[model samples]
Target: MTSAEVTRRRAMGAGLGALAGALAGCSGASGPVLRLRLATGPEGGPYNAFGQALAQAVAASGHRIEIVPVSTAASVNNLRKLDDGSVELALAMADAAEDAVLGREPFPRPTPVTALARVYVNYTHLVVAADGPVRSVKDLAGRPVAAGAAGSGVQVVTERVLRAAGLSGAPEPAPVPAADERPLGLAASVSALREGSVDALFWSGGVPTPALAALAREMPLRFLPLDDYVGPLRERYAPVYTAVTLPAGVYGLTEPVGTIGVGNYLMARADVPQDAVRDLLRVVFDRWRDLLREVTAGARLEPRFAISTGEVPLHPGAVAHYRSVYG
Candidate 1:
């Protein structure tokens, strides 16, 4: 080819490349959008389901909310995600958030977090099959138990309960694998117990969790009372633990069972934008009824009940939202 032809071809290629780069920059095809990231628990769990429902609700409110829901280990890991700025928002057990701020174990140092809202009450259920060998937390010793996924809030509560029950040194509970080796969340734990793979399972979630409710239909399940442990847990940790009871009709139990309750918080990093946080609070409270049809736990997120976030401070945007509505 002639030298002039070669030069012209090179210039054309350069021009096309520059145009492509400019278009890529403007469209951000290879870069992430500014949509907010919400970290939830393992897939198929209440956290995941609730987060998805919440994301949908927020998105439907307006184009201002574009949420990307991510499934991670519940609570503990979600806090870690907030710490590292990997996620803008997360659902966490109130106890785990307290532990993180206090620099407790599982957290090497204090991790700052702010409560967007007090979402729901997580009931700690020490569940077993009606005909299983395990009768109580004491009986969990030396038996295969689903202790929740490692690095999850459920596991933290489970370990604490075992310690409080004087069963800490008992053989490590069997890990309920979510998909592989990951610690099982509430849904998987119930499945493990129903399958008879584990003698007992420790699950912390909203009362009448769909999974447990469905399991109750297929077989009779029993919840071991843990009211005795609530006082100790509350005394040792923050006042995040409460002594509560699962009503007789819940989960098909013929009698009420005493258990501990921990509130769940919708948490955000301290630096999350006020406007975005404000929008979140808008959907959470203004359109709450819509969320109720989405997640059964949504019933617990009533406006009157959502302002009790314990030691975790509310985001200023949340504060404003509450004032605007309540005032």
Candidate 2:
């Protein structure tokens, strides 16, 4: 670990220890109560919903760990917050976490972020109106698209998909609206699509996102297939992109839609205590079903799946937790 990483770990350890001591003393409890801040996504997004569910599950698990979910702009923002020690935990896309570790775009330098688990897979949705002129990914060229909220993992993948489709340019400035310039959040993007302000929008989330599912009920929407771009994305970036299928009947589609899928990783700062991590992971795996109820449909959390966090190294606590399970 770098000097900065060591400093961050020490600071986090101190803060956690002090807080736990104070809480124990005040409550006269036998043990310390650990409180951790988890950075999730904006309102009505999968990250936010999942984080809330996880927090609730942890609270009910009879463990002393308290998870406080903090909503932000999603993956990129969450990782940045984790790096700065503002949050102890963050939910991020595999690509964003990879970039943070590799010190890619959006991150100024290599950040010391570690993965606790690979939670679930996020399907990329390139949504357009069912009756609109846009038909395919290429049709989005020169048209206004809500690429995702600023500083979101959705935007990171959206830009790559757009570039792969040959729509290359800096994201449109907020002041000067251009064909491909909208960076709206899930709720706002859905509203914009309803209002016809944006031609299409890019969103990465679990199948049947609440906002989009609700939108589908109100109006006819089409999800353009994006499986073709997955190969290029994987080739260019890390092998974090996969071709996944959205089955029919989801969002009222007549046929299944093939799209790019990325894994969502539950991340932590490098310096968090191992025992705390082990305890948290215990609750996570033990209550995995309850946690996924509100997050996604038809997903499973296993030690095998959780350990495949790609390039981001697992925290020492995570490794210990998994080892205890396997051994």
Candidate 3:
């Protein structure tokens, strides 16, 4: 709770209110201006990039709608913002959002939010320098590790995966700088990995992440398999995790890496106008091809599985969209 964070929160609040106000007023001729505040993850991560792309798509739809993308720590942070009224729309991991509602780890109490769609799967990448000593999660013992930024979904999953692997205290979690100071979450971790500040990095993101890909090109790297922890993780946390493979050579690796996949959800405050949510869903599902071309991770948002939000309830607007499509 730094002054900088307070100031940023205030600015976001203003933007959300302004958008809500505009959406409240409409004329049959031009329609009302709809402004939405979308809270995304770290600056260089997939959440921020995909959110910006979504905003652009909504803008290009020729509707009187404008989405403002705000960069914040992903997952846990986004749900907090939604609860406090600073963010109208956001992206969160299915597990973290469920935790928020259940007042589980990473959340102090139940947070009310609604899901627009289950957008994509974020694969856990336990990356180490190819020449480094660590070959597996157990090897990370007594080493420094970047376990993801504090208050991020990455951190949430990182901790669970480690605990399930029996390495909960094996490595020291990297110190996270203040929110405003951390522009790119994984970029900082990658820098630490490259500089030997940390021996291994735990990142949860869509495949072919720009920062990781760039790091792979500069130096050899390898992804440690988390196959052993999948069942235990499911037993401890929500069942939102699934097994997935990282194709060989995706990040220039020699063999496919096994990892757990967690779904990413597009979320909103429950009070947001149902019609507005419906329209947003339309932009996402109806024009999904456009999103897929823009964001590689967008390909995971299969319409048939879009409504499979675990603990967090789907927004009424999302329900309407599905009914319109199916019924």
Best by TM-score: 2
| Residue-pair clashes, model 3 | 0
Error of 3 at 271 (Å): 0.7
Order by lDDT, highest first? 2, 3, 1
Tell me the deviation in Å of residue 244 in model 2: 0.4
lDDT of 3 at 82: 89
TM-score of candidate 3 relative to the true fold: 0.87
Off by over 4 Å in 2: 1-26, 170-179
The per-candidate count of clashes, in order, stands at: 1, 0, 0
lDDT of 2 at 281: 95
Candidate 1, 39-102: lDDT as tens digits: 8988878788778888888868863556778999889999998877777789999889877766
Off by over 4 Å in 1: 1-34, 169-182, 302-304
For lDDT, the strongest prediction is 2
What shift in Å separates residue 146 of candidate 3 from its native position after superposition?
Answer: 0.7
Per-residue lDDT of 237 in model 2: 94
Candidate 2 residue 274 Cα shift, in angstroms, is 0.4
Give the alpha-carbon lDDT of every model.
0.75, 0.85, 0.78
Candidate 2 lDDT over residue span 1-327, tens digit each: 443564355345543432233232234564767788899999768899889998998888877788989999999999999877788899999999988887788887877778999999999999999999999877776789998999999999998988776675544222222347588999989999999999999999997787889999999999999999989899999899999998899999999999999999999877678888999999989988887777778899988989998778888899999999887
